[model samples]
Target chain A: MERRAVFKSRWLPYALIAPQVLLVFTFFYWPTGAALVWAFTLEQPWGGGSAFVGFDNFAAVFGDPLYWASVGRSVFFAASATTLAMGVALLLALFTDRQLSGYRAYRFVTIWPYAVAAPAAGLAFRFIFASEAGILAFLNQISPGLWNPSMNGNQAMLTIVVCYSWKYVSYNFIFLLAGLQAIPRALVEAGAMDGAGVLRRMRDIQLPLLQPTFFFLLVINLTESFVDSFGIVDIMTGGGPAKATNLMVYKIYFDGFKGLDYSGAAAQSIVLMVLVMALTFVQFRFIERRVHYR
Target chain B: MLYRERMGRAARIALLAACGLVGTVAADAQTRTKFDLWQGLSGDLGERVNDVCKRFNESQTEFEIVCTSQGSYDAAVQNAIAAYRAKKQPTIVQVFDAGTLDLMLSGAFVPARQLMEENGYKVDWANYFPGISNYYATSKGVLLSFPFNSSTAMFYWNKDAFAKIGETAAPKTWEDVEVAAKKMKAAGMECPLAIDFDTWQWMEQFHAIHNLPIATRDNGYSGLDAELTINKTKFVDFVKYLKRAHVEGWAKIKTRATGATLGEAFASGDCQMTQFSIAGHGTIVKTSKPGMNWDVAMMPVYAGTERHNSLVGGASLWVLQGKSKDEYRGAAAFLAFIAKPESEEYWSTVTGYIPVTKTGFAAMQAKGFYDKPTYKGRELAIQSLTASEVGPLTRGVRLGGFLQIRKEVTDALEAIFSDKMTVEQGLAQAVERSNATLRRFEKTYAGKTLP
Candidate 1:
């Protein structure tokens, strides 16, 4: 049965949600509006002046090769990090769902990492995977000059991707575990009575039922991997070693804030916002068709 | 009835005392001309800046400065710019070296010389060190801000490690450093030298001391029409040399990506030598391993290159516009106070930043401050800063959009060092990008000439 709370007055529901409505308008809509305006305008760093140059900022941004490179890196990072994090989380959730020994402890331990902040996680992983005098130092001893991320572009990209996935794995696990538990036990028991092995039961029943959850996590992971990786990228690579990790978000910050090219930065941000939106739309339009929602 | 009357009397007495306290607070606020000083340092350095304000407040009674830290240099400049837009700016803000040119062209400051003169302070503008002061000065040598927390790069080397390679002192030339690094490498040393990726040390300092122009038109001091000439210069050769050194297994990069800082690496005795700021002396003293013997020398140039003055690296105090006359007086007084010889000595003793004036250095020398083991080798920074007369090209860069330009150069270094691009290709592409930034900057402030 669908439940609904009836309001006594027309203004009651509006009053109840006014705070949230105000928050969204203030923090989200206002900034997005301002960025839209600033995208077509040139702002002086020291104030006192501005000029509107329609689409000049956008044209400059689109013409920049470095900007395009950052865009490509961002897309690659988004797909790689999302798949890696979600895959690891699904594996963890499956093992724990099997009711192994100390499953409760494993569940509790898994959620602890989600509490660790992104920058803190970035710093922790930065030291652990450090090329020299760190936990991975023994690799360099085996083959001298083999493990330095500072000099290697691909390795630098891998370092940030791994650190990004490590933080997000814990987050994805909690949701996947809940989705797995939401399934009816009787269906799985019937499949087991029919002599279906564990893997077969999961593939035929559990995974098919987990589609809605999978779609939900996919949207969040993909969208979040676009913008939320700023802290990790900043702390880990600062978009460096030849700008390998210079994602679009970090570039917007570096250009807009540090470089004080507010117009250029605002334009880059517009491009990033459009990219995230297009990604979400594509996922819903294409990927959601095959998702069987119960 | 009697108890109620007594309570009323007691309340009246308490209210009278509160009124009296408020009166005194109002009077104190009115008598002193209060102004805000937004500094861009924190932690130990921030404490020292606050302590300087405290000393100034104690030294006089006419005015008060409310000191606050914006946490970092970039934040301070950003906040100040934003505040200026809102017409809520502080009277005095600490702007970093890179921001000097940007602030200069913004036309938002009262020239330091004119402010002092109008405030009745007898400032010998020539007393400021040429190397330190020129960065914040106009094309004709008029200061636009007061040099605060000045420092320059020096070659830091481990004497103990160099002893293992039979070299007793720091290298004075690129050739000497190469020989020492190769010998250290031959002696089974894992990492002989570590260089960070900051363009300040590797590019600006390298070019400044070798009497080379980083850009045209006296590095943008003359006008706004200057373009980057870095690619056509010897920097390509320099990058190639560094690349070769890295390939030959003698030089190791100790940047943030490496999970170690250049200072920490040298301090921990892992890297034998590095070129970093003299201000890093404080960190080296605190973080160096036990019983490690190390010293610093002026950054080495090529063997045949005649040494010129290296540019300043830290920050300076810019008196922002739109402040009242009374606040200007207070700012001038504080500037004069910090410019004192004794104040310079105290500041350097506590913060490892070398004094920015010749008289300050002389006073420290006369007081035998440099004779102490803790303070030894710091005077070399002052010597390096004043190695020769300030030439047209050696007066420090005054280009617009310098922060972005520096990033381009660093990106070039990264690309070249990572083998993603050849030296000429990387530097040429960087120059092209940097020139575009300059063009945009020039367009932003169209028709405005350099001050």
Candidate 2:
């Protein structure tokens, strides 16, 4: 009788969830499947039907050095941005979790950058980094022979990395702060009673407790870094100084929208989607097991 | 039951009255054929268009013309295509020059010549400039679209910067330009010369000025099977000059996407000189504040090659298919009204676009409008654009998928500027890639050919 009652309750909830399930399938899954099909065909809007080319588009994508170069740059940007954002957010969250004065103000200020749109942040970075009359240029005017990324590729990439980190660190910090706040205070007190130092308490208790949040953050930050660099690269250098900063999404945009190579761009997009999905799956399968949830 | 019957009777009476009102409205709607116009011009130009449209709407009782701004040229084309697919396309759309081939191939445009003839409007196609009309017209010399807001390239310079560099006249040739650039650099200016450097301006005008083929078969006007021929010595020399300018700090290359306004940049003395469209003259004048000295000049020519005139750059109005007869008449009338002498004069004076009709230019000239010092050397640009023979290369590029090909050219140029590839290598790659694009376009648009 209890099993029957439980089954009946579940059925009601499942019935309640049916609409959302159908919505997702119709909107997301259906379009994604169609795009996957489109990736293999030569399709034009008013032209005749698309034909199956059997990996020809994919082969073209793989053969192009520019595509691979963009992939490499995207990986570099994502890795650098994700690492910097996670590290800075962790530090800021630790600092804000303390019983220090004006912590609220610091927290508010730290989280403020998150409120700005990604494109607006890119524009701000461009103004700050512009060579002719940027803030950095003004600073260089006073110092003479300071860092100028406008004419240098490595320095330009560094500037992009720094800008990406600046824009996203606040978001990670917000998540980390919330994660830290959720941990019981007694755990830290118990560690203190056991004669653990601040670093030990953080490393052993706090980090372990925040592992689940950290994993979620790690995935989110990686995706954000991979995807959001498109706007930054477009607004900042437009993959300039010899394509130093052309990320995958930006390349897709250029090929698809700007260059009007719809098939080529769709193929590139499929590859990118597969790569991201594989990475995300690996993160979930292998990395999630290591994330402890106390 | 008696109360329910009474309520039903009252509801029936209300429904009958509503039907009668709707019947009148439907009759009114049937009497007036409404035509939708999608355009990209905004600000003052858009307002002028609206004023003209308002006059047209008031001048007729059988048709109503509604105009809408659809953001940029590219956006307008995209929206038109999407709407075309949905069978809800507008009656008329203003497409940029780059979008011409795409529209021509789409087979959705109702040729303006046919529309005008069918609607009983008199169109003297011969009165239009041959060089300009040939670009937007069919091979049989029929106008496919109304030529509106046509412009050619012009050089703009800061007089103050020129004085500072000890130069009193505009550069007349590429060699002269190089010399002036060096002088400007010596005078402590960072960017002696800057150009928008768009693919259309740099490559297209390069071919135009040098009388070199940008593509085979008269830039694809003969057929769809044309290939790119822009990898010759003339283009190579041009790129080498640009590279030398970059290396020596005589010129600064900025992306067309991110570059500030040429006029504002020149006025502020950020750049000593710039090459841009004549259509920007109005903005140049407006942005040049009090005591700021700036002047217009003809585009510099290559020293050795035969100097051919530049082609038009702005958009033309295309009439779309699937409009009612009355709406077509209204569109033709609106076109004729805008093409009238007084209207063209007012438009040219307000905006910097050239008058489409000869009478309009004569009217402006009769008023001694060019005598104003502020308008100094403005006629030189027009005269230069009208100079010499309309050579095969200088006529205008009409290659299918020209827009995409231009982007590839821009990519190649950017690669060269960023030192990823040498000018020769970039040009070679650009030619190869552009040929591939042209081949694809030919395959797709097989039977389409210019008359």
B1-451, model 2: which lDDT tens digit per residue? Answer: 2354466567559868996877965565567778898987765666566666767776667777888877467677778877876788888898888778777766788888888888787877777766677778764556789988788888888788888878788888889999988987887888888864477667787778777888888887777888998887487888888888988889875442333545557766678888887877877777776687878887787887567777878899998877677778888878878888887776776677887666666777888877876555556656766676666666688886676677667667777876778888988887887787777555444455545
Once superposed on the true structure, which residue ranges of model 2 sit more than 4 Å away at CA? A4-18, A46-54, A139-151, B1-32, B41-62, B139-141, B164-167, B187-190, B254-261, B324-326, B372-378, B400-404, B446-451
Q: Model 2: what is its DockQ?
A: 0.19
Give per-residue CA lDDT, model 1, range A122-160, as digits (tens): 888788878885688788989986988777778889999
DockQ of 1: 0.49
lDDT of 2 by residue, A54-159 (tens): 7877887786656788888889888999999899999989989975789999998998888877666777877777665566667567774364565457767887
Best model per TM-score: 1
In candidate 1 the C-alpha lDDT for residue A29 amounts to 97
Can you list each candidate's DockQ? Answer: 0.49, 0.19
Cα distance off (Å), candidate 1, residue B257: 2.2
